[model samples]
Target chain A: MNTYDDVERTGMSTQDVEETGMSERAVLLDFPGADDLMAAGRVEPPSAQALARALAGIEAAVAAQEAGHAAGRKKGAVATAPLRGMSGRRRALVGLFTAAAVAAGVATYTNTGETPTGTRSETRADTASVFLNDISTVAATQSLSSGKYWKTHLTVGDSYLSKSMDFYVVNDGKAYKKGRQPDWQLGPKDLDWKALNQLTTDPAKLLQLLQTPPRPKSISPFDQALTLLGGSPASPKLRAGLFKAMAGLKGVTLVGTVKDSTGRSGTALEFAEAKSIGRVIVDPKTSSILEYTFTWTAGASKGKATHQTYLSVGFTDKIG
Target chain B: MKPDTRQHEERSDGAPSRDGGSDAQLTRSAAGDAAAFTPLVQAYSPALHGYFARRMPGAADDLLAEAWLQAFAARRTFDPSRGSARGWLFGVARNVLAQHLRRAGRQEAVPGVEITDPWQAVDQRLDAAALAPALRRALAELPVEEREVLLLVSWEQLTPAEAAAAVGIPAGTARSRLHRARGRLRDRLAPTGPAGRHLSVTGDMA
Candidate 1:
């Protein structure tokens, strides 16, 4: 377990406080649904089998655009919208963002190859574990920017509630403590950056670090790993380690390719809960999480289960 | 929250753009540069599919096609200054959903397969999982306005402003509504002194 405790937590910058007009902001108040909201709207990239269909649709869409373009050319449609990120306002926005912001994220205009290849790293690990590890690589490469806050959009796919939500952790030294559930609301109060900075890429050490101070007997190592992966602003190395650890946990098994509610297909990992089947769908190519779902494999809600589809996750310039 | 009569209009439909193709490409697409539009389609299709999938489940693919077709038909109307191309496309999706529901009439609320249990059944395996069923029920019980704002920010990852745009409300109104909704959720999720936390429900947003 790597603890950068030798380094004190970074304090909120004077500029951040003065500009954002916020101080002592602990738990994210505006963005709600840490539990219930995690289960919505992340579209998994097309699967290998669905590739042809998607391509065909893309062709049609392109053709439609072509037709529209031709029509516009014929009609001479003038550029009506704000003239291409060049306005004074856009410049101001661009100004607010320095090299730091550019380093922080790859803006859409500058990003390329956004589509998923539908290819997973060839690994004998649990396909799901491979997926988690793979996605960690994606995050690992992303640059972090110094900003007012760090945000995450995560989907929680539990038995009865499969949900998605956006979570924010300011530079303030507070994180969900390593103990109980409701207590997590009051969990370890420390600098999130410090803990994340202390994260070790080594899966074994990372796993041990995650269980620091120990957790309730009811909480399995799998649960703890998940808590960090889904909750913390962990480095990609840390996220990958968590996935590797998750693969080693009992009851975590490959469930094969599964289509999410949105009809996108990905490899799945399933673990049996007392009353339901806990499932995770992972995009093979990007290693990004597609969905989390818990279906009642038994009991009254047998046919009922909730799922959270993560729309997107990243460190962004804005919190909204 | 009481789910809306017209979900597309009533709920938060500010679907976040994944590929985030620039508005320029959309401009090109409108001008008939079909090639310029390919990336946009590739970028947006999966997310568009998800948008409908949550509402109509398996019908997501077909609805996605219809929405794109409609978008192509009205590509000229897209004004980047007013909003984003994705946001505009989502508005189109909302319209398509509305049209689909209007055609279905009384069956509007029943887009996906109907589950027998009004009470969604879920079993908690560990300490964290225990929170699910409890929150699910409480979520289902919230007012639609608050629920809409909450889900827009929390689930869709929309900024309050984006949620405002998607849900057709003032940004301030969206923020206030989100605040109230969060309050309700906080009361239900972390009750006073860890009382009976497991009560009851999130209506199927799907």
Candidate 2:
């Protein structure tokens, strides 16, 4: 038997291979056509513009790391601060200010014309709220469509749990895993096709529904909202309502445009609580959730990020 | 069968120790020195860009940029003790490719059918007309993992060990895969056979 050792020893020298009685050499050299395949696969080097952009991106990341290190040193904290890159941080701050302004505007609109100290509050609108509202409007414009089944393909990864899972669910009235035969349920709070379709499209009502429940304390209103957004075959109006409701949530803040795991760029929204942080990436054009990630901010699982990418979601007649 | 001289010159840790600079540069870059990363980028960007271009021709530039940013962010995780920086970079590229494919709703490996006869599974997607038809058919029929290893060696010019590192497989597995792929290709392309004669005529036409 010709072993791998004999193959490696034959080397890349044709002359030496001919002198040595190695069958592996003949195997390696017989495919002269491989050279053509290699030539065919050749591509031109990256253009100067692409190279420059890549360098700039790297430089920004470096600068962000350095800044994070400096901040950590000044605070007497560990040098493990999250590196949001310079551009991302700037965008996040801008989004925060916008969200804050929008909250103030909403508060002022609902104000009874006086505070505890009998002073009137000022009204303002920030960027993130406006962005989300705009997205909601676009989402509402999406034409409603339906099929026999609502199909979703999702990939989930959790660093804290050290688990990776993929869910391909096709739901008509009942949920099926991958196809019709096998029954499926997605976690404890899973809603069936009927529950999903019956979800009220009213933004305020949707928020109330998500908040009211005998749910675990760990499943926050935000988490519930995201779960529905990801798993449901909600109509265009419902999706718009979901975004509008999420926009009003206390801790939800825009993180600017960021790419998901799949490399498709989308606007990112983050909600940081006492123990964990949740982030959702939305394709504003279609108002669809591209990805959702949650990371523990404190305790044993601190800094471990779990994420789910919604590869696709659509209505299909057949389940597979 | 020309040996890739660069692979031979690499240090045990996998960093090219040609001038004893890459390892030091990588360390400095990981320490947040942006300037140190420039040389490393210049050294590997062409091959890395090619890696993306081969699989995803249209979005190669954007994918390359994304991969570099990711690599820079994760630079601290690159242990020279495990593999060379090139192998590490290629691994990153592979990940980027996987992500891109996932977003596009495509599988990296074409599953299901086990190609027995090359003619039955000729991959019409490949545009390499200059390559022998029989060999191309044989290649298209090779299992995705074996094909990946073979290409990383024959095209990317990585040794079996380096290819293993790039593909996140064991060195022994990579060598055996390479050996099997070579033997299969030779068998399919043997000149004395009637199938081989038919393939040669078709190869010229192509």
Candidate 3:
């Protein structure tokens, strides 16, 4: 029978169906043999593991919100809470760091035979140095894992230029955009994976490598350092050296703890130049780059910021 | 005849009768009650999970988790006065799917791109299994806007008004699109006999 007959069989006029909702089965009855097609399109329900993970995420999120509310109540003003009320995850991280610092203090005393000094206030420069060094120490301990391809998923947001876009670039022997075709010249440099792999991990030598030609003269040493840290699969030792080299750069300063674009909190370090300012947020515990932001300080694009959030990065056997 | 209030009674406003107390639960959940929110998650997780799985199989779990997280963060913004919570949730899922496809550089899979067929993957599956090719072709030929409305109704089991909420269109517009889509599919699938010929002439007249 024609589709009209099928609808007529439902005993409701088309207008009646529209004004008042039709039954689920009646909705598809107008299309001939749609039941079979709909059945074919059905997929199995979500795995129990997926459901559990989703529930756990919701629980953590709700807990964080509750903690924020409690802190706000105790402080009498909501504004004061953010200053002292870290998320459960961040509080745990702080506790771990405190324990690590005590252990480091004991080691210093045993090795050098001197009493540990009392805590003192630090200048911004000292703070930046100490933070970078802590990240370097963590980075150095990470064991390298290998796979067929090094994949980096990044979301790029430009405040003035255009809308934010997310894209992934994968590198094997050659760089590929979304695992599609070879991207010969990506970013600022004509990236040669072979050359990048052979670069020195010595902090002093890496600093020199970043300063020389083939690295564009216009891009600051700090910006180039971030590009290497973010885009390439640098070994843990190399990553450690890069952070150390950045610690020595003249214009680098700590922006303190801040949340990245994806709302994950991390330590932010800013690098100021003549015409632009650049910032990179790092998850110090894991020594992974969370975000990189660049803002033009002069000319037509002044005050406009470009934020690139590093969503996921790792070596994977397959790319898609 | 008295209008069928059966479907309307279930999904009239922010408070659906089928899942009673959801509106109150949503409000409590927004107020930072995790326990109140657990029921909503348990109720909708299966349907939302299926929604993602059909579109992007491998990344479905991650996408589902991300969608729920985003939904929770923005729960305060959900106004039940406008539409059903279920429809609003599906709207969020649609946006998540679009963002995912865009991130993956799969422009063709992104919705609102009318010319490019978004059903190629689903079509291939049907084709491989030697299932209804004619119906599949008819569906694939429907414009993205109409096909989306139809699928939201047929597959997701949303009412036309609920589908309208999901697609971010007016209820009237969604109904018309549903009407147009069903009409076209009916025409295409009609048997090629004198009856079909007569129906085609009538369709042309309409």
Q: What digit string (tens of lDDT, one per residue) describes model 2 on residues A1-320?
A: 11122233322333455456444323443353555665555567689876765654454334434443444465555323433444765654544454455445444322322332211101111123434555676566666887765666676421110001223443444534432221112223355556556656787766556555524567777777777676566787787887676655555554556789999977776767789988888776567889999999999999999888988777666645
Candidate 1 deviant stretches above 4 angstroms: A1-33, A39-55, A61-320, B1-21, B106-131, B193-206
Clashing pairs in 3: none
Instruction: Please report, as a residue range, the 10-residue window in candidate 3 chain B with the lowest summed lDDT.
Output: B8-17
Model 3 per-residue lDDT at B7: 46
lDDT of 3 by residue, B102-169 (tens): 54455474444522124656566567546677777667666678878887866666767777887788
- Root-mean-square deviation per candidate: 27.0, 22.5, 20.8
Question: Who wins the DockQ comparison?
Answer: 3
For residue B182, model 1's alpha carbon misses the true position, in angstroms, by 1.1
Say which prediction, candidate 1 or candidate 3, comes out ahead on lDDT: 3
Model 2 off-target regions past 4 Å?
A1-30, A80-320, B1-20, B31-35, B108-129, B196-206
**Which scores greater on DockQ, model 2 or model 3?**
3
DockQ of each: 0.08, 0.13, 0.14
For lDDT, the strongest prediction is 3
Alpha carbon lDDT at B18, candidate 2: 54
> What is the lDDT for A68 in model 3?
39
Q: What are the per-candidate TM-scores when only chain A is compared?
A: 0.43, 0.53, 0.53
Q: What is the interface RMSD of each candidate, in Å?
A: 16.0, 14.2, 14.1
Quantify all predictions' global Cα lDDT against the true fold.
0.47, 0.58, 0.62
Model 1 CA lDDT for position B118: 17
State the local distance difference test value for candidate 1: 0.47
